[model samples]
Target chain A: MAYKCYKLESILTINNLTKKFGYLTAVKDLSFTIKKGNVYGILGPNGSGKSTTLGVVLNVVNKTSGDFHWFDGKISTHDALKKVGAIIERPNFYPYMSGYQNLKLVCKIKGVNYSKIEEKLKIVGLLERKDSKFKTFSLGMKQRLAIASALLNDPEILILDEPTNGLDPQGIHQIREIIKQIAAKGTTILLASHLLDEVEKVCTHVVVLRKGKKLYSGRVDEMISSNGFFELKCNNQEALVTLLERHNSFSKIKVENDLVTAFLTEPMRSDDFNKYLFEKGIILTHLIQRKESLEEQFLQLTDNQTNQI
Target chain B: MLRLLNIEYYKLKYNKASRVLIIIYFALLSLMSLFATIKFNIGPIKFHLAELGIFNFPYIWHFNTFVASLLKFFLLLVIVSMVANEYSNKTIKQNLIDGLSKKEFILSKFYCVIALSLISTFFVFVVSLILGFIYSSYTELTIVFSDLEFLIAFFVKLLGFFSFGLFLGMLIKRSAFAVAAMVVLFLIEIISYGIVCGINKGTELADRIYQFLPFKSLWNLIDEPGSRLSAVKEVAAQIGEDLSYDYSVRWYEIAIVLAWTALFIFLSYRLLKKRDL
Candidate 1:
C-alpha cells in the first residue's frame, strides 16, 4: 500500500475539557494535542477517563465544559469527523445482520463508496466469514469487523477505545498487527488503552492519565530512557554494596535478592564500573544496564501524583 | 431525506421482528375484511349487513376506515420495536459516532413512520376498491368514490398514532416498557375523559374540550358509521345521547391530529438532542 504524505500539522487540539456526571467528575480539565501521522496512545488505569476523553472528542458524549477543535480550526466538528473513523467502548453492530450488510450500513451513513467493503473485509481476515451474522462471530472476529468498519472510509484519522479488550493472545496479536499496518500507511491513529505494554509497543506518543488528570505526556522513548539504571550481581554482595555506597559516581544504591542496583549520578559507561570493580578485587558475575520499562514509569508517575495530593 | 429513508428501509428489510409483525398485521387485516362479508341470522331477524356493509358503495370508505383504525396496534408495535431496538442494541450510539447528526437520526425514524402509514393506507384503499366493485349495486365512479374523506382521515390517523408511538419509544427507550406505556396512556386518557365528563354533568363546553385530548382527537378522525342495522344504530344513538357528544368527524379534529403529530415529532427531536446516547 502506498502511504500518503501529510504535512506536519496539529490534527486535534483540546483545551480544558471536563465532563461531570452529577457530582462525579469523569474527566477533569484535560488538554492535549495530536499531530499528524503519529500513533498517539491515551494511557491510563481503568476509570482514568481514557474512554471518556475519546468519547467527548468523537462527539458521542457531550462535554460538560471546555471545547476541542479538529484540523486546527479548519473545519467544524461534523466536517472534521467525516475524515475520522472511530469505535468507542465496544464493537456495536446489528447482531442479526451479516458483517457485509453492517459495513454497508456504515458506508451509507459515512457517505463513502461501498466498493471498499470487500477490500476492508479482506484486510481484516474476515472476508471468508463476511456472510456470517455478527451474533455468530467470536469475540476476536467481532473486534476485527469493528476495525474493518472504521477503515471503511479510508479515514485520515482513526480513534479506537480498548480495541483489544477481551481478546485472547492470538486475537491481541492480530489487532496489533492490523493497527501497525494502518499506522504504517500514514493514517494518524488515536487509541485509548489501560494496557501498558500495548502503549509501549504500539504508540509513538503517549499521554499518561491518572484519575482523569494528566500526569505526563511526551514521546514514549523519552519517558523510558530519561532514568537509566544498572543491575549487578557480584560473588560478594556485601562488598559490592559497600563499594557503591562509598563511591560518588553512583546514586541510590539498593540491594535486592543478592543484586545491587543504582542510578548513574553522572554520565558513565558500564565498562568503567566493571574495570573499577576488577581493580578493587571484587570479582563480577553479572552487570547489565537497563532502561526503565513503561510499567515502572507509569506506576512511579501515578504514585508520585497521588502523594503530591 | 430519501437517503435516510433508504437507510431505514435497509435496516428494516432484514429485521425478523418487523417482517413477522407486518405479515401478521396484513393477515389480520384480511381476516377483518373477510369477517365483514359473512352473513348470519338470529331467529326471525337477519344480521347480514353487519357483515355486508363493508362492501357497499360509498359506505365502504367508512366501514374500511373503522376496521383499519382498529389494526393501528400493529403499526404501534412496529414503531416501538424499531425505535427501542436502536437503544438496546447500542446502534444509536454507533450511528452518531458514524457522523449522523441527532436531527437526522430522528428524521429517519419519522420517515419510517410515514412510509409505514402510507403503505398500510394504500393496502386499505386497494382492498376497499376491490370489494366495492365486486359487491356494490352501483357501478358509477361517482357513487363508488363518494365520502372518500374517510380514506384521507384514516391515513392521518395512522400517522398520528404511529408518531405518538415513536415518541413513547424515545421516552421509554425499552421496547416492552414503551408498549406497556402506550396501553397505560390509552387507559389514562379514557379514564380522564370519563372523570371530566362526570364532573361537568351536562356542560356541553366540557364535553367538547374532552374531544381534543391526544388519543381522543385521533379517534375522532373517523366517526362511527351511522348506516348500521336499526338495532345497532339505536344502541349507538343511546350511548351518544348519554355522552352528550357527537361522533361526527369535524374539521378541527383533523387539525388537532396534525398538530399532535407535529408535537410528537418535535418532542422526539428535542429528546434526542438533549439526551446523550
Candidate 2:
C-alpha cells in the first residue's frame, strides 16, 4: 500500500486519554497521533473539551484514565516538555515583569540562551515593546508575546489553544500569519481552536470533538462528507428544517440560525433540492451550493451535534 | 540547584512589593542597634539599655538573634505573596508547561526560603558583632565568638518559620488566607497548650507534649535572653530569686525545628506534585 511506503516518526501519541471534573467528563476516550511536521487541529465547539484534551497532554491537568506518550516514553518526560513549546488558555505572564524579563524566565526554564530571546521577540514584532511590562501590552500584543515566548526554545512541536480567541480581526490576522510562517518552516503544530475557519485555513488534519466526544478525526479533505453541501433558507425555517430532516434525498441535514445545510448522499444539485422542497409546499428564499471546505467541515460538526443531541 | 535559585532570584527581583518588604525587613534588622544609644538620666540615677549587658558576649549572640527573629514575619509575607502571585497570574501552570517539573518548582521555593534565612542570619550576625564591639566589655576574640550557636539557631528558626509560610502559600494559594492560616495555627498551638496545661494542673505534661510542637520547638531554639541580663540576675539574686535557667541554645531544639522545616518542605512538594496546577 502507498501508506506503508513511507514511515513517519510520531512526535506525540495519546491513547484513550480522559479527564473528568466531578461527574462531567471534559474529554473521554480521546485518542490521536501526530507524526513529525503534522499541522493537527483539534476542532470543536466552545464547551467541547478542546482545551481540556490539550491540558491533559501538557501535564497541567491530570487525567482520569489512559495515558499519552511524547517521543518514545509512556509518561511525559520533563526533557520532552522542554523540547516542546505550548501556550495554554490565556497568555499567562507576570504582569509586573517586562516582556524581556518574562521571556528571560522562560529561557531559564528551557535552558536557552538570553540572546535567543531578542531573536524570537523580533519575530513577533515585540522587540520594541520588550521593555514594557506585560500588563501594559494590548491583548493582541500579549498573544503575540506569548507566541514569541513559545518559539524561544526552537521547539520541536508547538501546541496553541485558541490562540486567536478574544482578538480583533486584525489581531487574528497577524497571529495567523505568524502561525503560518512557522508552519511553513515544517514545524509540527497541534492547534486546538473552536473556529472552523481557523482549522480550515491552517490545519492539514483535524479532529472534530463535541461535548467531550470525538466525532471525526482525519485529514481536512476526508472531513468533507461529499463533493459539496447545499444550504437553503426559507421563511418558515422551522418547517423547512423538519421537511429536510424527514426527506431522504440528503445523507445529513441541520438548521443553524435560519439556514439549513444538507450534505448530498448521492450527489444532488441545488435546483433539484429546491424543486423537491417546492413540491413539498415550501418555497426557497435563499439557496447556495457551498463548495468551500469550510462549509463542508462546519456542516459536518453541526450535523454531528444535531445527531448526538 | 544554583539555576533554580537564580530563577527565584529574578522572580523576586522584579516584584515591587517583595522588594519593598525585603528592604523594610533588613532595615528593621539593622535598626535594632538603635536600642543601644537609648540612655536617659532621671534625678541622680541613669538607666541605659547597653549598660544592662545585653550586648555582652557571648550573650550578645542570643540577644541579637532573638530580637532579629521577631522580624521574620516581614519576609514570610514576601514569600507567601510571591506564591500567591504565581497563582493569581496563572504563571504556575505556565512554569510547568515551560518544562519545570513539579519537584523542581518546589525545590526552587525551598531554595529561596533557605536563601532568605541564610541572608537574614548573616545580616544579623554582622549587626550583632558591630554592636557588641562598641558596648560589650568582654572584647576578647574567644569571648566574641564563643556563643555563636545562637546564629545557627536563628537560621533554623527562620528556615522553619518561612517553610511553614511556603507550605501555607501552596496550600491556600492566597496570601491573605495563608497569613490568616498562620495566625490560626499559632492560636491553635497556644490554645491547645493552655488546655493541656490546665488539665494536667501544671506544665509538666504540657511542656513535655508541646515541646515537639512546631512553634514550641522554634521558641526553644533561643530561650528568651532577657532573664540572662546581668542587671536582671543581680536584682533577682537580691530579691531571693534563684535565677537558674537554661540560657544556652540546645541541639535538640535545633534538631526538632529542622525536622519541622523538612516536613513543611515535603508537604509543600506533595501539594505541588498532586495539584492539577
Candidate 3:
C-alpha cells in the first residue's frame, strides 16, 4: 500500500506521565509522541506499563502526575476520545448481548452513525456471526468483535493493547491483516504488545519499555539495521580471527567453537569480506550476514538496563 | 443527559435480570393492592382495610404511598445489581474507553434511578386513582386532590433510597455483596436506633433526632395510618391529635431525604472518578 502523507501532525503526545498504585509504580515518568498514520507500538513484557500507559492516555485510568494531549489539543480529553477507538488489556463487552448489539452500544456511546457497524463487522470477518451472543463466541471471535467495535467510529486513531493476545496462529494473522488494512486507510494505530514478533511484523515505529521505563524508541528497521552482525566459519578459524582482528571494519569480534561473530562497523558487502579474507590465504567456508531480530534487540536492551540497575 | 438516559434504557432493556426484577416488583405490588382491598371480619366487627378511609379520596394518597414504599426493595435490588454488574462485567471500563466521561457514566446511572423512581410513582398514582374512584364515598374534586403531597413524598423516598442503593453498589462493586450490605445496613440502622433510644431514655428530643437518621428519614415520609382497626380508633384519634406531627410530611424530612440523595450521588461520582477501571 502506498503511504499517504498528511501534513505531519501529532496524533498523541504524552509527557512525564506517571501512575502509582499505592507504593507500587505501574508506569513511571514516561513520555512519547505518535504522529498521524504511524503504527506506533509500545513493546514490552507483561507488567511493563504498556497497558497502564494506554489506560492513562485513554483517560480510563487517572494519571498520578503529568499530562497527555490528543489531536494536538484541538479538543478536551473527552471530546478528543470520541475521535479515537481503543481496547485495552482484553476484549470487554456485554457478554449477554450479541455482537451486533455490542457494536450498537459502542456506536451509541461514541455518538456515531450506525451505518458503519456492518462495514466494520465485515472488515473483521465477523459479519456472519454478528447475531451471536458475546459469551457464545470463541476467544478469537470475541477479539474480532472487539476490533469491529473499535472500528465502528471510523476513528482517526486506534489504540490496541495486546490486540493479538490469546489468539491462535490464524487468529493472530487475521488481526494483523485487519490492522494493516486499517492503517492503509490512514488511521494511526498505537499498539501495545509483549510479542516482539507481532510488533516487528506490524509496527513501523516502536517504543521498547522495561519495568515501566522506556528503553528505546525509534523506527523498527533502524533499530534492527544499526545492530547488524555477520557470522562466519572457516577451516582455519585461528587464522581467520587473526585476519579479522587486523581489519577495522569489523568490530566486537568473538570466536566460539570454530564460529566467529562480529558486528559490521560500516555498510560493506559480504562478498568483499570474502575476497579480502581469500587474499589472506583464508578460504571462506561460510559468510552469513544477520540482521538483528527485534526479539534479540529487546532482550539485549532490557538485559543492559537490568545490569545497570 | 438525554443521550445518557437513552443508552441506559437500552442497557436495562437488554438485561434479563432487570426485566425480571421489574416484573417481580409489579407482581408484588399488585398482590399487596389485592390484599388491601380484601374484607375480613374479626370478632363482632367486620372491617376491610380498603373501607377504613384507605381508599377514601384524601387517604388514598397515604394508602398508595405505604403500599408503593413496601415494593421499593425490588427497585433497590435492581439498581444494586445493575450498578454492580457493570463492574463485574467490566462493561463500565469499556463504556469509559468508548469515550464516555466518568461523570457521564455515573450520570447515566443516576438518570436510570430517576427514571425508575418516576415510573414506580406513576404506577402508584394510577392504581390509587382507580381504587379511590371505585371505593371512595366522597365525590368532591377537592377531596380527591387533598393530600397530593404524599405522591411527592413517595417519589422523594424512592429516589433517596435508590440513590443509597447506587452508593452501596458502587462502594461494594459486587451485586451479591452490595445487596447483602444493604440488608445489613438496614439492620444496623434499626439496631442503632434502638440502642440510642435506650441510652436517651426515650426522650422526645431523642426521638426527634432519631427521625433524622438516613433510613429513618426516608421511612418517615409516609406515616402509618391509625384508623385501620376499629378497636383502636378512639385511641388512634387521641394520639393523632396529641402528636399533630405524626400524620403529615414535614418540610425538614423532605430536605433531609434530598440531602441524602445528593450526598449519595456525589459519593458515587467521586468513587467512579477516583477509581481505576
Candidate 4:
C-alpha cells in the first residue's frame, strides 16, 4: 500500500507525564508526541503502563503529574476533551439499551449532531445491527459499537486502548481497516496494544514503555531499523558460517535448523562478506538485511527492567 | 441543553424500562384502586374509581389511598431502577467520558426524574379531576378549587421525592445498594408513620415527633386544611394561627426541598467529577 505523506506536526504532545496508583508508579515520566494523522502506538508487555498512559491522556484516569496538549497546541485535553473521544479498556454499554441507543447517549453527552451518529455506525459497519440490545451483541459486534460510540462526534483525536483486544481475526482486520480509513482522512489515532505485529503494521510512530518508563519513542521504522541484522538462508549452512566467521565485523551468530542468522554492528560490511562467500563456492540462497521485529526490539530495549521484559 | 433533553427523552422513550414502568405503575395503581373500591365500603357514600385514566370508575380521588396502597412503593422502585441501571450498565461513566460536564450529568438525571414524576402525577391529576366531576354529580359532595390546589401540592411533593431519588443515586452509585436503600427508606417512613400515629395513638410527644416524619410533611401538603392530617395545621399549631394566615404556600417548605435537591445534586456532581470509573 502506498502511504500518504503527512505534513508532520505534533497533534498530541505529552510533557513528562507520570501517574501513581497508591505505592505503584503506573506511568513514570513518560513523554512523547503523536504527529498529525499519525497512527501512533504504545507497545509494551502487559502491565507496562500502556493503558495507563492512554488513560491519563484521555482524562478518564488521573495523572499524578504531567501535561498533554492536542492539535498543535490549538487545543489541549485539559479543557478540550470535547474534541477527543476515547475507549480505554473494555467497551462499556447499558446492556439493556440497543447499540443505537447507547451511541445516542454518547452523542448526547458529547453534544454532537445526532445525524453524525448514523454516519459513524455505517463507518464501523454496525448499521445493520444498530438496533440489537448491547447484551445480545457478540464481543466483536460490541467492540464495533464501541468504536462507533467513540466516533460519534467525529473527534479530531481518537484514542483507543487495545481496540482489537476481544476481536476475532476477521474482526481485528475489520477494525484495523476502519481505523486506517479514519486516519487516512487526517484524524489522529493513538493506539495502545501488546500485539507487536499489529502495531508494526499500523503504527507510523511508536513509544515503547517498559515498567512505566519510556524505552523508545520516535518513528516506528527508525526504532525497528536502529539495529539491523543479517538473515541468511543457505543451501550450505556450514560453508556460510565459515565464510562469515572469517569476518570480525559481525558480533553474534545463531544457527537454527539449516539457516544462519547473524547480527552486525556495521551493516555496511555485508557486501564484502557476500563477495567473499560467493568466491568460496557457498551458494547464497537468500542474503537479506533484516530489520528487528517490533517484538525483538521491545525485548532488547526493556530487558533492563526485569519485570517488564 | 434542549438537545440534551431531547436526546435523553428519546433514550427514555425507547427504553423498555420507561414504557414498562409507566404500564406497570398505571396497572399497579389501577389494581390498588380496584381493591379499595370493592373492599372498603363507607356507609351510603359512593366513590369514583379510575384505573389508568379510566374515568368515573368507582372510587373518589384519593391521593392518600393511592399513597397508602401503591404509589410510594412504585416510586421507590422506579427511582432505584433508573439510577441503578445507569451504574450497572456503566452508562453513567460512559456519559462522563463522552464529555458531559459533571453538573450536566447529574442535572440530566434530576430533570429525568422530575419529568417522570410530573408525568405520573399528571395522570393522577387527571384522575382526580374526573373523580371530582363524578363525585359532584352523583353525591352531596361539592368539589372545590381546594381540590385543584392538590395539583400544586403534588408538584412540590414530586420535587422532594425526586430529589430523594437523586440522593439515593449519589450515596450509592451501585444499583443494589441504591435500590436497597430506597426500599429500606420506604419501609422506614411507612413504619414510622404507623408507629407515631397508630400504635402510639395519643401521646403528645409522639404527635410532636410525627410533625417531623420526612414524608408526613409531604402528605400534609395535600391534606384538607383543617383536618388532623394537614401539614398546614401542624405548622400552624406549632407557631400559632397568626403565623398560619401570614404564610401563603410555605416558602420554607419549598426552600427546604430546593436546598435538599441542590445539596444532593452538588454531592452527586462532585463525586462523579472526582471518582474514577
lDDT of 3 by residue, B178-209 (tens): 98897888899888888887887884666688
What TM-score does chain A of model 3 get? 0.94
| Model 4 agreement with the true structure over B1-277: per-residue lDDT tens digits | 6755665676667667656766787766544435335433488854433322222222234353335323645655666666766777776656666776556766777777777667766776655555546433343344333434445556666767666766687668665677678678768877776776666566565645644445655544554333322444566777766433321245555555566656667777777666655
| Stretch of 10 with least lDDT, candidate 4 chain A | A1-10
RMSD from true fold, candidate 1:
3.0
Q: Give a tens-digit lDDT track for model 3, residues A164-239.
A: 8889999988889988888888788888999888778778999999888888888988887654778998899888
Two-chain DockQ for model 2: 0.72
* Interface alpha-carbon RMSD, every candidate: 1.2, 0.8, 0.8, 2.6
Candidate 2: which docking quality band? Answer: medium
Preferred candidate (TM-score higher): 1 or 3 = 3
Between candidates 2 and 4, which one is better according to lDDT?
2
Q: How do the residues B1-277 of candidate 1 rate in per-residue lDDT, one tens digit apiece?
A: 9989999999988899888999998877766657555667789877775344557778778888898889889878989989999999899988888888878889999999999888888888888888778777776998887888888899999999999999999999998999999889899988877787778786365558867778888878987765453445667687784323454567888899999999999999888877766
Worst 10 residues of 1 chain A by lDDT: A1-10
Alpha carbon lDDT of residue B179, candidate 3? Answer: 85
lDDT of 3 at B100: 91
Please give the TM-score of chain B in predicted model 2: 0.97
In order, candidate lDDTs are 0.86, 0.89, 0.86, 0.70
Off by over 4 Å in 4: A1-10, A72-79, A111-118, A231-248, A253-261, A269-271, A277-289, A307-309, B27-70, B136-143, B147-153, B185-254
DockQ of 3: 0.79
Superposed model 1: Cα runs more than 4 Å off: A1-7, A72-74, A235-239, A246-251, B50-52, B202-206, B226-231, B234-248
